[model samples]
Target: MRALALLWGCLALRASAALTCPKEMSGFEGDTVTLRCTYESELRTHPKYWCREVGVFISRCSSKIFSGENSQDVMEGRVSIRDSPGELALVVSLRGLTLKDSGKYWCGAQRLGPDEACPVSLTVVPATAPEATAPEATAPDAAAASPPAGSSRPTTQPDSSSSAVGDPGPASSSHSSMPSVSIPTTRLLAPILVLLALLLAAGLIALSTHMLWGWRQALWAEDAQRGEKVHLPAAARREEEAPAQAPEAEETSAPCRSEEEEEEEEEEPDPAKFIAV
Candidate 1:
């Protein structure tokens, strides 16, 4: 039992020793990438395969690839494997890579020491790079097109670039020829603001007038309730008093009584006074 356990431990250690490849290999999706691995003469007899990496080791690898010079060629779906007898090298061809194919992988021979297994990290990039577009081709204008030889019109080759480079550039001319904004500003906004201000002033005046009138009316009503009456005009009061004093004026204008009638009545005495005597 002890000997069996030791053998198992040694096998596990050998399986753990993985070979090394390019740490990171990047390629565009749908493109083919070649992975070349070299091995020793002792490993030439071992079966080789490719696998997805797990942790530090390889797992879920391809089927055992035929090794030996007799079967020099091997092909799977999109993958191909070849062992070159001259250089003692193993070459793996992976094709039609997708973005999902980017990850760690392993390439190795079966039952070889862990050092023979190769761990490669593959990075598949998107293949959708933008292509450059060519500028549009326009027919030359009549002035710029060269005239046919031997014509007597003496056609001058109009510099196609003359318009672009004038006394003042088109950009400068555009800047200089800008429309006057002051006119529109004064014509459009100034009048509207003035009209709004005038309306506001008129509204304020109307409000003030209404408020003053209401306050005056309220004061007048309160005065009337308190009986602080207003004095009437002289002519109106005189008209009102004239009939009220008519009888008093008539009595005051009458004649006085006689003094002689008062002296004759002085000898008479009361009847009760005479009986007491």
Candidate 2:
């Protein structure tokens, strides 16, 4: 009997040492969620996995989404798993969850015996829409309460006709004649307009600067062309003057040579006359 009791206690202790995980988790569609599963330190070296449970009656993790052998991270599609040996835990991440992903899952570790696993129910729901803001209420205009222009106030006089009969003279309406007007706030429009104005101003400034720069460049080109034209005309005048001055120099030298020849002939005695003497 004592041996049987001891065996039962061992089984209970073994059951108590199973993997631990959250009972339920929830996430919105297109959102990501993280789950941490802890296990005994002895199972730290075992391969860890995060998988979906299949079958209605007998649920089992047949669809393994992600698994990791060591402390390295393992990723498959939108699911990822990482084992932490120091913490003796497995971290699983699910991204871009959809409504179809709402089902039971298991955090499991592979061993020689039956794999250690814990059930975790995940719920995925559609994302909620943002709440709409109410329109701002405007106060009634003061001018609307005033009487119309060119209208005189009539004086009220005591009635002398009725003595005994109670008379409710005129039913004064309590309702205001002015209609309620709702003014839409232009909170976003102001910034958009300012941005557009700034962009337009910047464009105009850029265009003006470009036009001015182009005009200056054209002016500079025209000035350079004018300078070249002026320089070419002066150089042509100098070349033409050079040929004219050369002819004048040759004519002056011809007269000087004629005078020298006449002087020399007159200075020398005639050789024929000397022979005759």
Candidate 3:
């Protein structure tokens, strides 16, 4: 039974070295980030070391420990280690985390009288959005309107004294009761409108350039075809005129070179009637 217990303890120690971190880790700035390292273990006095592995070097982390009363600078204050010391889970609190605090961390624990250790990966996520504030206009202006006295009204009017007179003017009462309303101007949005118009103009320009290029290409092709046709006829005419012999006279009569012409050549041999026989 004692041998069996020793074998079981050895198995548990081997299992504790297989501790791993969680798959998903997310936390906002100024929030707590828990590096979950779950493992199987039999010994509770073994100390686990958490380090940040950057590139090829491992740096020591000064965070809290689950050994009850032990804590470091990085692990002090709000920082805490899990209740189950054998589990090897760690929690680090960043009071006001900034962008520079993002990094990857790893946790490991060494066996007591042997050369064996386990490690797990950890991720630190910083906040994305900026802090919120009361919604207020960044730029406020109220000098667009002028009164009948040819002067701009003050942005804030002072409280008036008690008057012995009758009802105040409607314009005066209205202006005093209401907050100054600054009218929106087309000039304020001119840059955006101009940018939109320029984009449209650029599209039109590109389309026109494409159309003109296509038209020029078509016209060039047509001209090339016509020139080829003209050159072919001229070449044919030159070939046909290759066997030129002479420039004969322009005569209206037919040529006299056949035997029928010999009859015509020999004058009419008029013969008297053959009286004899």
> Best candidate, lDDT-wise?
2
Question: Which is the better candidate, 1 or 2, if ranked by lDDT?
Answer: 2
- Please give, for residues 49-160, the per-residue lDDT of candidate 1 as tens digits: 6766432221334344554465466787777888765676777777787776666666676663333566666766554332222233123333333222211222232333
C-alpha lDDT of candidate 3 relative to the true structure: 0.43
Query: Ranking under TM-score, best-scoring first?
Result: 2, 1, 3
Better of 1 and 3 by lDDT: 1
lDDT of 3 by residue, 48-112 (tens): 54543332121233331332424332444444444355344444333443334445444445555
Candidate 2 per-residue C-alpha lDDT over 96-188 given as tens digits, one digit per residue, 9 for 90 to 100: 877777777778777765667777777665653322222321122222222222112221222222211444132111112322221112333
Better of 1 and 3 by TM-score: 1
**How many clashes (backbone N, Cα, C below 3 Å) per candidate?**
2, 0, 2
TM-scores of the candidates in the order shown: 0.38, 0.41, 0.30
lDDT ranking of the models: 2, 1, 3
Q: List the residue pairs that clash in candidate 2.
A: none
Error of 3 at 219 (Å): 47
RMSD, each candidate, Å? 25.6, 24.8, 19.7
TM-score of 1: 0.38
Off by over 4 Å in 3: 1-17, 57-74, 86-95, 112-277
